[model samples]
Target: MPEKVIIRSIISPHQRESFTQFIPLSPDMTREIGRTVKEIFDSLGGAALLKSSRDVYVKPNGIDAKAYCYTRPEVVRAVIEYWQSAGARQVYLMENSTQANYTRVVFEVNGYRDICRDTGAIPLYLDEEKTIGFEFTGRKSIYDGDPRGYDRSHCEMPVTVTEKLIRRRDENLYVNVPKLKTHSMAGVTLGIKNQWGFPVHTSRGHDHNYNLPYKLTDVLSLLRPDVTLIEGIEGTVYGHYPVTALADRCVKPFRVLIGSLNVAAADLAGAKILGLDRADVAHLDQAIKRNLTGGVTGLDDIELEGDFSTLENIDILGDKPSSGKYPADLFDFFPWDVKVLKGKELACREGCVNNPLTLLQVLFHDHNGRGGWTLVMGKGFDPDEIDEIQGRVLVAGHCAIEEVAERLVKRLGKKKVYLSGECNDLAATAEAMFHLMKVNPVSFLPRRRGAAVLAFLMARLHGSKSRVPNPLSHLIKMV
Candidate 1:
């Protein structure tokens, strides 16, 4: 007999006049979250699981410090407090934020530090720790073979984690906490996709292109969470990153929490709530086919506790009439003067094509549209088209730079050409585009200027070489 999988979701019974005014850290909200977390924990046998081990490691989606992009600190506090009440000896909150952004800075910006100080949960910044390489075997590439002649069957990647998490895996409990959001690359970012942050920043781009789904699944194979809690109080659309300009249209306040011991089941339920089918999210689909879903073969297999019907479908970019096939379509939401040119041969939707475009959306919205610029990505651009390009050209990704950097420099001159060489390297891309568009990085935080400056300074003092927009880097380059 297969193990039974039950996914329990709790919807806040309280009614509010305006969903837009929902405050995540409000006293009322915190109490509600605490109650919901305890109910879910009791329902999912979390206490029984905790009986075997007193140590707990909680991994939250600290992808970025941006609002609505990461798991709310309030939700994490509730989870930590619940675990403590259930006789947990120690709870360690760990995360290595998105590439280019340091975990220390992210923790400060997102209030994880405050949560740790208050809840007595030790904060673990994975990036600051040493890493060891772990090999994942018997994994098959979900996409075509890499152009660089590398086999995806066996992958050995470095991960920044304590020895307790690896050596004493069975002795401690691992909880996965992720925010509900739509991803331009993986369709939906849930429990399975949340583990993407485990890999070191440098190794992130290795299979980030077409084989991202396979890479994500391979990570799951190694670091499968014992319990998954999907925080859906304020879900985001139009990709995982927060879009302040599109907050009205993009952010969805579902006021619900989805939990399960089986990560895949929880993610499947999350996908449904996001108005996506099983096949829509490639990572979830692949995990199901690989039998990593804890015997959950289909939606029928899950015994759901909450009413999914009452939950409205989130409006993601993919749901648009244009299907969001190209990065250019994202610009339609804003009146930004930007041109995204993809390779005629093939544009990797998972990385090169969408990553830069997503960042551009944030920049355009926050800064009120930079001047007209052309972004060249992927490979195989026509010479005539390259010559006709106007203004500064941002040559993004390794393929684009190798293919058209020389031509762009020759036709448009060296001063007109900017290079952000890496597959979905947001830090380098942001810096390159910031220079090309002449946007000040400090200007991004007009209201929280002091906090932002202090965070950056502290991260620097701590010897963090993170690629997040650095004021000093900008000052030196622009000078």
Candidate 2:
């Protein structure tokens, strides 16, 4: 059995009134958050648990360039403050952002840099050194890597990890600060998902078939963090929701911090706060099977504090929308699922006029049932060539919003005009035309690879709408 995990909660709303009277934290939520965090650690037997004489490494989530989409800067500040108070030496804040974005950038821009500077801890990048390969002989699992590339095992593979971070002197402690977010591939992302940083040189752009949750836990088991702090102050139901654009979706005042010795247990407790099933996450499932942190089967192992009823205000994870699909749910047709963009006389005034064409290409590839695809452009072709193909038309892009809606309404019945854009509000506007106000990722890519496929599919499914002048040729360079 793994050690019992201690989980704590402090729920509140992100209101100006609730944030009154606090220290360097500025917001009242900070003081409550600090207290709540300290309470959990105290119940777990205190910071003395990390008095071993070794180098302590801290890893915070840094997958995106967005600030609010990540862990709150105050949470890291509070943790560092508490750790310094506990008499820790040589604190290193580390992360390997898949996007190659800087953790310091996120921290500095989000107010964490000052906290670290004032606290006297240095920041380290995880991708800076050579790594040693480690094998997982435990069990056959999901995300099996092909050993043929490096003469390795199906389940076992070489992993590049920093040597300096491997062994702590004696009093070393590793703290994992992770943000809670919903993943499109994995059901949810949390502390375990943060472990993707461990790989010394792997770029985030590399695609893997299985969910990252399992692999993350496997990596963490090797690192064996002394404790984990999951910051839930603000999280997204939709994965990769940029901090600046969508922090308000966080309906509940999750002014709480959850901590635990058992990473799995802590994750379980955190997932509960979000109303997600532990089993729903493949990483947590794999962790349980491999017996990492004593295999927590449920939330029963956790000791909760504060009024968790505040969580009742949280929306169901499935019911949440990411970017697109307000009146329509994007999740309904996620990843190979059918999506019907039923519209009449659709027209593209801006963005990718060739978007419907590109979507048609995608549909063709889909029909071929082949996985890998590439859309390459060669020498210039005549604009008249645009008449060669067909599909239902729709205006999708940032520019399409200016006046395309009214024009599109004149051609396609008002009900058929759905605005798709990178902006949810714009898509929501289209939904409003249909009499439902909801956010959606409606912006369509014109002639781009993904857009090509979507356009192709629409053509195959709905037949080509009337072919116009194909102004997309002129705009091709803009893409």
Candidate 3:
């Protein structure tokens, strides 16, 4: 008989009809979360896992500092409190934020510093710590024989993790806390996708293209979480980083928490909660294929603890999961006059295609849509085929730069051509787009003018070298 992975899902008594109703952390909500976590530990032989002498490290999904994008601080605090009550030696909350952003800034902006101070839990910024190299022997490329695929020559991938996590991995507990949300690239961001924070920001772009799923799975194979807890209290729809203005339509109040010992099993349940099947998520499919599901061969192998059927299916990317294509009407609602001309040959949904599109979505929604530019991505665009080109030309990604940047620049003059080179470099993309639209990049920040200026200064003084485009450097040009 195949090993059964036990998944515990708890639905809170707090239910609201409106999706926009913001649920703040209350005493009742805390009690429910605490009970749910205790129940999960009890089911998993609490005596063996929750030891008094063990060190605990909790990894929360701090992808972005924005609300509803990262893991809720309330959830992290509950996990820390539980471990502390069990007499754990130490409980550390750690994360490396997404590219172009600093983890320290995220901690400050997301109220993690207060959580750490109140709970006596230390905040470990992985970006500032030293990284150790681990061997990766898995298949390097998703494509069989493509020269442009992930480099097979380099067998070691350096991840930013402390020596404690590397040396005392078996002596302690590692928990993964990720928010349940749909991704424009990976279909869904859950426990499995949360490990993307392990790699340094500079090296992330190496395998950020079509091979992202395999890369994410490879990272999981190296450092699998001991406990996977997905915070589903409030889930984001359409995509993970929807602006606050769009929260009414984008955020859903699920009031549910899902946990499991196996990351794959936890993600499978989380994906199902988001109305995604195993086939819809490439990483989940790859994890099962590689036997990383902790004997969860498929969705049928899971033994659910709660009434999963009561949870309605929240649409993943407008009810079109696994399509690997952005919604046809993503830009229709906005009155942005920008024209996106993608190449006919190759467009990796995970990288060049979605990166700029997501940024554009943010610009359109929050910044009032900066228009009058022609953005070109991917490859195989013959300059001769295009009869008339709109406004200024912005070439994105290495593929587009290599294919048509020179010709486009020659036709449009040097002043009109803006190049943003790299697969998923949000910093470069933002700079190019801002330049083309003639908008101040600082206007995109959520903080007020004074706070934004102070935050930018603080980020530069004590931020990681791996941070792309440096927040201060980008803001300096605009100011």
Candidate 4:
């Protein structure tokens, strides 16, 4: 029989605290927090998992830390210090930031560098590190209906993993500390969802089979977190990143969830804490279908030991069950399912949008109702309507390209209509829209502009080797 999948929780005494107070976390708080973690860790037999381990790998959820979207460095520091005191040979803090941006930027931008220095830990940017690949047998379901998750091509092709991780022995443990947040694609991001960071991001391109849930299932089966720690000190409601505490959609749910030996179970408890159904999340549902929880049954099956009542009905990003999803009001202008195309049909999936709305949302943030950009996605377009007064029409998918690209471009002129050649690719499409809006997307990022400026000045003044120079800017404002 599989070992029992046990999970527990602790209501942070400071769940009522504000996010802005930057006072140093006191030693008393640290010790108590460490005690809380160690209690849970010991219960999970995490120390035995660490015995004679080649290295201690801490995978904390973040591109960089902001208010509620990342694991608290204090928590990570506590875990590392505990293990170090327990005679860990070496400890390494590792992450691969989203968008393939600079990992060091997050380390510096989020005070992780300081955490590393204080804790005597080293950092690893998985994106820049050496890697190796292994074949994934797609016998597992890789898609919605497809019982087999990946295709023969995916199975035949070697799935690459970081060399540092691939080379480690099975007993060398992986500690997964993920932030608590609702995801747009996966419903809620906790333990299982957080594992997405482990894979090389480029594998997500059109070729590698776009089945995120199944892909994660295969990866988790091979190497999932030995212990899952859900960071709820602070969290976001709808989506991750480019979010502000109050302005975007962030919330503080002063709670921490710990699970022993099962990532899915930990996520199950975390999902309920976020007031989300286990069925609503694709990956969670898929895990059930695959029976990948190491014999742990459903959400009810997991043994819960904590102040469960405290987690009920916490206000998230949206409201009700999805306090974590973005507010629908942001789409009042281009309401989802309202046909903007001439005659194209758009299939609506749960927790997904058709058009590339990233640029629109960002534009709205900077210029809410004033921006003159109108997006018409899907197929079927009336030439007369398309020719009428307009700023730019964003052809969102391949269907639009097939149906309207030529006529629309001929009438509106090449500069007027932007075609996102691929279907439903938000990043590429949003970038195209950014060009139409006369704004560089990079500058919109918090500290990227400052960094670019520094890199430029460095090259100009010091004959720098690289294209751009570095800037001395404050990314970790709170830190």
Candidate lDDT values, in order: 0.72, 0.47, 0.70, 0.55
Residue ranges of candidate 3 with Cα displaced over 4 Å: 1-23, 50-53, 141-145, 151-162, 309-335, 385-387, 438-459, 470-479
Model 3 residue 439 CA deviation in Å? 4.9
lDDT of 2 by residue, 1-479 (tens): 44455445554435553221111334677787777777776776566766656445677776533334557767777777777666666677766544323333334444555666787888654444334566544334324564211121122111223344354324467788888665544556677777765653232212122323444565666766668888877555434332122233422345557677777777776666565666667778777777775656766555554444333334423453342221210122122422222113222211122222223222232222211211111112233332221222233433343434454455544444444442112212222221211111122221133434443344334422111112232222111
lDDT of 1 by residue, 1-479 (tens): 23333333444443343433434556777787888888888888967887356889899999876767889888899999999999999999998788767787678767888899898999887766656776544254335553543233443332334356555677889999999888878888889999888776766765567778877877777768889999987777667775676666677676678888888878877777677767788878888787777777656666666444322343422343334221212334543577878999868777788888877877777665575889889998898887789888888888898899988888788777878765777777777767766677665543445665686677667655345755544434421
For residue 225, give model 4's deviation from the true position in Å.
1.4
Shift of residue 278 alpha carbon in model 1, Å: 1.9
Compared with the true structure, model 2 gives a TM-score of 0.59
lDDT for predicted candidate 2 compared with the true structure: 0.47
Q: What residue pairs clash in candidate 3, if any at all?
A: none
Candidate 2, superposed: residue stretches over 4 Å from native: 1-7, 11-13, 16-26, 135-161, 168-171, 201-207, 211-214, 250-252, 305-479
Candidate 3 per-residue C-alpha lDDT over 185-248 given as tens digits, one digit per residue, 9 for 90 to 100? 8888999999888877766765567778887887777778888888987777677777666776
Candidate number achieving the greatest TM-score relative to the actual structure: 1
Q: Rank the candidates by lDDT, best first.
A: 1, 3, 4, 2
Deviation in angstroms for 106 in model 1? 1.3
Point out the worst 10-residue segment of candidate 4 by lDDT.
Answer: 470-479
Per-model TM-score on C-alpha atoms? 0.87, 0.59, 0.86, 0.74
TM-score for predicted model 3 compared with the true structure: 0.86
- Predicted structure 1: lDDT: 0.72
Ranking by TM-score: 1, 3, 4, 2
Clashes of 4: 23
